[model samples]
Target: MSVSSQHEGLCLRYPEPLGPQANVSYEAAVSMLMRAIQLAQHTPFVWGYIDKPQEGHIYLIFMTQQLPFPPDGIRYQDQEQKIIMPAGPGRELEVMEVKFGFVPNSSDTTAWRVRRRYRMHKGGHPQLVLIHYGRGQPMPIMPNLNQPVRNYPLRPINEPALFVMGEKIGQKVYPNQHSGPAERPGPPGMGMSFGGIGNQQAMLAQQNNNLEALERRSQRDRSGSMNARAPPPARIEDDDSADESDMMSTRTLALTRYKRNHELMNEVFMYAAFSRKKEFPPPKSPYSVFDIANVEARVAKMTAEIDELRSKAEARREARSNADGAVGDDPGDVSMEVSGTTEEVPT
Candidate 1:
């Protein structure tokens, strides 16, 4: 069973397909992985992950080294160690079991944990297996290589992994939230580090400085303040990854402008057909109301023009024949035809 949340206007009518080279948002990818872990340990049914051997190894190392503590059942299979979270109340214990995709199925968790512990004490790579279940119960199963989930959002190694999962991941499975001056121990050996949401926001702000530079160029263009060739967009030194991200960002802005222009055109046409004065809609209506008071002046002018036209028609009718008088209730009536002359409708 699946549950979903949707926002109407924000929903894309036709979402573009993500190319193989596209970069997934770091937070989104990590959040999904956290969900998978949560499912593996918390749910009675088997839940698992299947990834490249190298990625699997990196993930194991990162979690054990960097993370504060494993949620109830999270057991790192390779290293022989038991990780526990900081003391707290209102906490639920989980039973987690994880299996590497390429690892052998016959591996024993307790024995493997002992070995991992021995090797870590000796300082080396350990054959790790996480067990958060009873001996009689089955371990979580990893998807087969051929059965690897497709279309799941995941970040490519080349992409900048700029996200902070904090003391816990998302609003699920464990440390729901955290705030303090406690200097958390981060992952060692690996070039990775952990920072709270504040650090991630700083990184994002630094990145957007490039975008702000682009905005200044645009402002120059719109104002014609400087007569010069527009500056080319600034590209990050790292090859096409930054370019790809910037392209995705720009496409959204362009599409937004396109929609806004179309909406404005429609509103203008609606007002043209029926004067705003005739149908003064709500202030917040989509129709234009910039020159609302002026519209009344324009309407009065139009009425005067129509009155002048009626006077001219009366004079022509009187000149044609004094006895040429007729009353017709039907708007379609065409009596008293005058040749070589256009007839004005009775106002």
Candidate 2:
């Protein structure tokens, strides 16, 4: 019976692939080596690194000259050293063990950590070995590598390399026969950034200015002023309040003009219909011409009528005032005072 001890970085056995009578193959060995190499390659080494040739593992030091202190585990592995893969479970006695310590070199001392693990399996035209991002544990044993995993590196080199290197390796791994011409630059023509909402906004503003100018001109014309040539004021802010106000004002002006035009048209139509009626013929005087003597006579008659009305009003007012004054001044006396000058005498 195999006894297991657990620790921070302890490597435990894989379940199905373990137990008695399990055969290990060259392919398994190669895969395990690849896994180890892949882990190390992905594990970045900064100013210093450790070599553990005995366990077939490497410890990378993460104390650079630039840093003030040796960072914590994940920080040491990830940020300071810029390593991608994490250190796995470290155990002893057939389990993956990572030995870490600080080795002082001159003025600075760097912390070093290493991870290692292995398993054996069989049965395939080409046998399968699997590795992934976890502390090695006995589970429904790691899956067969024959089936592909998407977005995960298949081989060890893939985990460490950059995009360009991966692309080249990818092409090598799965060769394609098809070839094509190089891709061309961006969109055609005199390429300008004026094709979007900015252009539309500018155009709308210009149209609004034109509308305002026309509206001002129309207002001036309706008021019968030739010297009136003024444009609408500029909008100060580009916020919701300004937008709502502008829209409301524009709608009001449009409605007003529409109503005015409709009324004018209706009046014109009514006048036309009335003029065509059989009872009243068109006026005989297209532009009525009257003699100067006739005009003078009419003016004199109008003046005489006005004067008569004015005299009557004045006489009434004077009579009312005198009667009131006499009544108040002498209640017992009711005397009548009449004069041809109706303006002053009571009737």
TM-score of each: 0.18, 0.14
lDDT of each: 0.30, 0.30
- Global lDDT for candidate 1? 0.30
| Worst window of 10 by summed lDDT in candidate 1 | 7-16
Which is the leading candidate under TM-score?
1
lDDT of 1 by residue, 178-262 (tens): 2110112212211111212345555344434433443343344335522343543453333225422332234333444577688
lDDT of candidate 1 at residue 146, scale 0 to 100: 24
Q: Assess the local accuracy of residue 106 in candidate 2 as a C-alpha lDDT between 0 and 100.
A: 18
Please list the residue runs of candidate 2 whose C-alpha ends up more than 4 Å from where it truly belongs after superposition. 1-288, 331-347
User: Looking at candidate 1, what is the lDDT of residue 296?
Assistant: 88
